[model samples]
Target: MRQVLFLTKIFLKNLFRQPSIVFSSIILPLVVLWSTWWVTADLPMTFELANAEQDVSSSMIDVHVVTGSLTAMAITAGLFGFIITNEYRKISDRLELVGYSPTTTGFAIFLSLFVTLSFSIVITVFLANFLAAPKDPLGLTLAIVLVSLIYVSLGNLVAIIIPKATEGTLILLIVAFIDLMVLTNPMGGGVYLESWTYYLPGFWPIQVALEASFLGNASVSTMVYPLIYFVLTVILILFVRNARARSTMSFLSGGN
Candidate 1:
C-alpha cells in the first residue's frame, strides 16, 4: 500500500506539472458544462420524459442538456487515461525494474486517475445542480461517475494500441462527438432512441443519466448496460497488462 501511494503521488505530481493536462482534465469539462447550459437555457427546447408511475410526461430542457453534457465529460477522462498511460509508461517500467511489482504500478495508475476523475465529476455535478437542480442529485452524480470511469478504461486501451497522444485524443473526440452529441442528445437529433443506436458506447450511460435527471430514478435494466461495458473494459486492460509483463520478462530472460 505504501508503495502504491508513493507511486500515485509521483504520478499525480507529474500529471499536474503539465498545465495543458490540468486544463483539459479539469477546466475543460467545466467550460463545456457552462457552454451547454448557456446554449440550452433559452432554446425553447423541452424534452418529454415518461413518468415512472403514471403515463404522464414532463418537459425538462435544462436538466436534459446538463445530463447529456455529463456524458461528454467522459471524453476528458478518456484523454487523461491516454495521456497518463503513454506518458508514464517508461516511468512505470523503470519502477517495476527496480523493485515495484506490476500490480503496484497498475494500482498507482488507477489511483491517480481516480483522484482526478472523481474530482472532475464531483465539481461538474455540483455545477450542474447549481445551474438546474435535478430531482435526484446523487443518482445523477453516480451515473456520470460510472460512465467516466468506463471511458477511462477505454482511454487506457487506446493508449496501449495507439501509443500516440495526438491520434488517440483525436479518436476520442470524434467518438464522443458522434456517440454522445450527434446520437444521444435530443438537440442533436436523438429525441427518440433507435434500436440500433443502443449498441453504441454512450447510449446506456446517457440513458442512465436521463432516467435519473428527469425520471428521478434510473432503472436496473437501464444501469446494466454501462456496468457490462465497464466490466469488459477492465478485462481488456488486465489482459494487456499481463501481455506486457510477459513480454518484458521474455526479453530479460533472453528467449529462455
Candidate 2:
C-alpha cells in the first residue's frame, strides 16, 4: 500500500512537470463544456408526452442541453487515458531499467491520470450547475462521477494496447466522434441501445447521466456498470504487468 502511494505521488509530480498534458487533461474539458453550453443556450426544447400536449418548458430544454453537455465532458475526461498511455510509452524503458516492477509503475501512472480526469469532471459539473442549475444536484454530481469513471477506465484499456501516442490520440478522436454522433445521438434513438452496446464502457454512464438529468431517476444497475468496468480495468493492468515481468525474466535468462 505504501509503495503504491509513493508511486502515485511520483506519477503526479511527473504529470505536473508536463504543462501540455495538464492543459489537455484538465483545461480542455472545461473549454468543451463551455462551448457546448454556448451553442445550446438558445435552442428550443421540445418534449412529446405520452398522452398530452407537447409542452416546451425552458427547464426541460435546459435539462436536455445539460445532459448533452455532460456527455461532452465525459468524452473529454476519457481522453486523458490516451495522455497517460503516451506518458507511459515515453518512460517505460527508463522505469524498467531502474528496476521498478511494471505493475507498480503502470498503476502509478493510472492513478495520476485518474486524478486529473476527476478534477476535469468536477470542473465540468460545476460549470454546468452554475450555468443551468440542474433540478437534482446530487443526482447530477453522482452521474458525473460515474460517467468519468467509465470513460477513464475505457481510456486506460485503450492506452494499454496502443503503442504509439499519435495512434492512441487518433483512436480516441474516432471513439469520441462515434460516441457523440452515433451512439448518443437522440435523433438516432440513443435511449434504445442494442444488447451489445450495453457492453460498451461509455454506455452506462451516459445512460445514467441522461436519466438523472432529464428523467430524475437513473437506474441503480446502470450506475453499477461503470464501477464494474473500473474493477476489470485494474485487473487487466495487473495482468499486463505480470506478463511484462515474465517476458523480461525469460529474455534475461536466455541472454545469460
Candidate 3:
C-alpha cells in the first residue's frame, strides 16, 4: 500500500517535469478551447439569466459543437496520457526487476493515469467554463475525470499489446481522431448515426459531457459506458501483465 502510494507520488511529481506532459496539460486544452470557439463563433449563445421571469435558448448546433469540442479534447488528453505512460513504463520495468509486484504496478499505473490525465482535464474544465459557462460544473468535472481515467487505462493496455511506444501512440492517435470526428460529430444524424457508433471510444463520455455542460441534461445510463470501459481496461492490463510475468519466469528458469 505504502509502496504503491509512493510510486504514484513519484509519477505525479515527475509528470510536470516533462515538456510534452506540460504541453498536453496546459496548451492542448487551451488550443482545443480556442479552436472550438473559433469554428463555432457564429453560433448563438443562449444561457439562462438570474431574472426569474426569463429562460434562454440558443442554436442547438452551437451547443453540440461546444460539447463535442470538449469531448475531442478529452480524447487528445488521453492520447497525451499514453505518451506519458510509455515513459513511466521504463520506470516500471526497472522496478519489476527489483521486487515489485502486480498490485504495485497496476496501482501505480492507474495513479499515473489519473494524475496525468486529470491535469489536462482540469485545464479543459477551466477553459471550457469561461467559453460555455457550463450549467453543471460538478457533472462536467466528473465526466471529464471519467473520460480521462478511462482513456489512461486504455493507453496502458495499448502499451501491453504493441510494446513499441511510438507505433502504439500513432495508432491510438489515428483511432482517437477517427472516433472523435466520426462518432462524436457535432452535426449529428449522419454516417455516425449508426447504432455501433455509440460503442466507440469517446462516444458516451462526449455525450455525458455535452449533456451535462450545455443542455443541463444528464442520466445515470450515460455513466455506464465509462465504467464499462474502465473494467475492460483492467482486464486487459492484467492479462498482459500475467503473460509477461510468465515469460519472465520462463527466462529465469532457462526456458525449460
The TM-score ranking, best first, is 1, 3, 2
Off by over 4 Å in 2: 41-64, 93-99, 187-192
- TM-score top scorer: 1
lDDT winner between 1 and 2, please give it.
Answer: 1
| Model 3 C-alpha lDDT per residue in residues 195-255, reported as the tens digit of each score | 6776776777766766676657556788787789878877878778777866876798799
CA lDDT, every prediction? 0.75, 0.65, 0.67
Tell me the spans in candidate 1 whose CA falls farther than 4 Å from its real position: 41-64, 190-192
lDDT, candidate 1, 1-256, per-residue tens: 9999998998888777877866877788888887777665454544533224433233345755555556557778888888888887888778878878777887789789878777788778888777767777777777788778788888877887788788999998788777777776555654446777777777777767777766678788877888898888877887887688778878998968
For residue 56, give model 2's deviation from the true position in Å.
11
Model 1 residue 60 lDDT score: 42
Worst-scoring 10-residue span by lDDT in model 1: 48-57
Q: Give Cα distance to truth, residue 157, candidate 3, Å.
A: 1.2
